[model samples]
Target: MAEKRTGARKSSSDGDDGASSRKAPSKKAPSRKTPAKRAAPKAEAPRRATATQVAARAAQQLLELTGKEAEGVTGLGRADDGWTVEVEVVEVRRIPNTTDVLALYEVTTDDHGDLMGYRRLRRYTRGTPGGE
Candidate 1:
């Protein structure tokens, strides 16, 4: 007669079914946290114009009205409201080259280099000296 093996483990320590090897999972405590508050952004100040930009704006404004070209920029300044620039322009052409007439104009512009207004300060000939 042939005898067949049953294959069953005789002791708990000799077998590993996984359920007897692991411990129960522990419970974790709940966390209590408050979200932080954010600060509001501030408003930015207006930007000021540069000296070069101010002079260029003045010349452009003068040319837009007179059609005459600007000769040079004489002065630049800043006021409470905006910037100021002094520009020289050729007003009238004369027969003799020394008799050519030139004019000094005061131009005002905003902080952003926008031309606001302009006015003629004085007129003189090209050959005339600076004191007048």
Candidate 2:
């Protein structure tokens, strides 16, 4: 009887084994790109002060300058560069509340509510007409 092959053998026509005839798909990494730059935002300007803010600042500054307590805001007016505020303060104490002496101060401040200057306009008793 003739001898038979026991295991797999290469094909003479393709020079490879039967299992190596089919190949696996190839694998590759994806490409990358650099990021773009962005521009910075602009800054905002300072805002103007309101009538109430200006009045409060004027009263506070007057108290600091004269060492007196502010009683109330009597007047407020807008200027070209800032504001003019009139503040009332007690200058002297008396037995009767109505007889107490008070003073009106004209306070000037910049648009940002910074004290520019201040001066006492007039002095009168609490019961005086129009607080004059």
Candidate 3:
């Protein structure tokens, strides 16, 4: 038999007033975020050019000589003169990868031919722009 607490009947045999004495829990709203407590932002890095930029410059020079596009260039360094850019070039007629490409030079002078660091980059079609 169910136990009766004063007037109400309960499942427990002890006549304790559990349902009458306890109150229901209330729901709370989320707290607002403060600007002072926010996380710090990250900084960005500077960009750099790839090795391909050098080869393109060399190929562009070769095209001016042959009247057609050159495919690639190789030797890049300082010589007896100013900034020396020796480029190997193949006209568009022969095999694209032919070893017969003429090595045309694209040299920049410092008023007196001297050494500036240069890169003999990848094989490219001629008319490549002056790189950054």
Candidate 4:
């Protein structure tokens, strides 16, 4: 899949001057595709992790994709990027499952806990506030 990357600016000010700033949303055009045979790969990979390392790595990976730190999130899992963490977030629309998937954001940082880049991949209700 091709990634459409675009940068957006979010104002940090909470001032309300009765003004609006918006742009027309861009729509992606769908293209026809041919169905391909579905078959599993016959190759296997070797193990390279211990139990403790696995859990710690999972938590770190979650912090990168979703902005939420591990402090407010739980139920981490393996995602395409590295991990998927669930959290109770208000930014997401409060729907049941499809809409309210408050997954932890992933962010890159240095030795210090300074945030670099982050984005959310998916949302789930597991381990959310009130235990979802």
Model 4 over residues 1-132: C-alpha lDDT tens digits?
123222111222222322234344768778555355335454655444543445455456554554444645444344443433343343454446455545545433322222334565455554445432
lDDT of 3 at 98: 36
What is the C-alpha local distance difference test score of each model?
A: 0.80, 0.82, 0.44, 0.44
lDDT of 2 by residue, 41-63 (tens): 44556788888888998898888
Better of 1 and 4 by lDDT: 1
TM-score ranking, best first: 2, 1, 3, 4
**How well does candidate 1 score on lDDT at residue 59?**
95
TM-score of 4: 0.26
Worst 10 residues of 1 by lDDT: 1-10
Strongest candidate by lDDT: 2
lDDT by residue (tens digit), candidate 1, 1-132: 122232333344445654368654867766554344324445567667688877897799789988978989998898888888999999998888678899999998888778888899999999788875
- 1-132: candidate 3 lDDT, tens digit per residue: 233453354344233556456664857767666566464444544332223444455455445544555534445544344345565544344454433333344544222332233333444344453342
Stretches of model 1 off by over 4 angstroms after superposition: 1-46
Model 3 score (lDDT): 0.44
**In model 3, where is the ten-residue run with the lowest total lDDT?**
109-118
